[model samples]
Target: MYDWTQDKAVRVLTRLASEGLQTDQIVDDIISHVDDFRYEAQMPTFYFLSGLTGNKKVASKVASLLQR
Candidate 1:
């Protein structure tokens, strides 16, 4: 029942990232929805991932996730 087509989820995540409020839970949530995103919307999700640099582990996970 998750509607990935909506931009609301990505926008909230991006806002959290832009504010330097990213957390492991947030990153995990993003990853959980990776496959749900449309092509155009993926870019903003990538932007959200890019903001999660405070944790090296999360950064590495994001790197590998993007490679897939």
Candidate 2:
């Protein structure tokens, strides 16, 4: 079974990095887990990235995805 504690850690770290609310450690975490995150974490990553950098494209993509 998936270990949600670890999974949640990955998500949290990725979000922190995306928000620029972190240092290199969170980025390292994101990079280290990138492969495993392809399925579940992609949307959260996009959400956090959009929130931090105000990327309209990412936001629009998420919006479109939700719209469907």
Tens digits of lDDT, candidate 2, 5-42: 55566557657666667635655455445546555565
Q: Tens digit of lDDT per residue, candidate 1, span 1-68?
A: 43565567776865675576756667777767766777766666776667655756557766887698
Worst 10 residues of 1 by lDDT: 1-10
- Cα lDDT of candidate 2 equals 0.55
Q: How many steric overlaps are in each model, in order?
A: 0, 0
Highest TM-score: give the candidate number: 1
Candidate 2: 10-residue stretch with minimal lDDT: 49-58
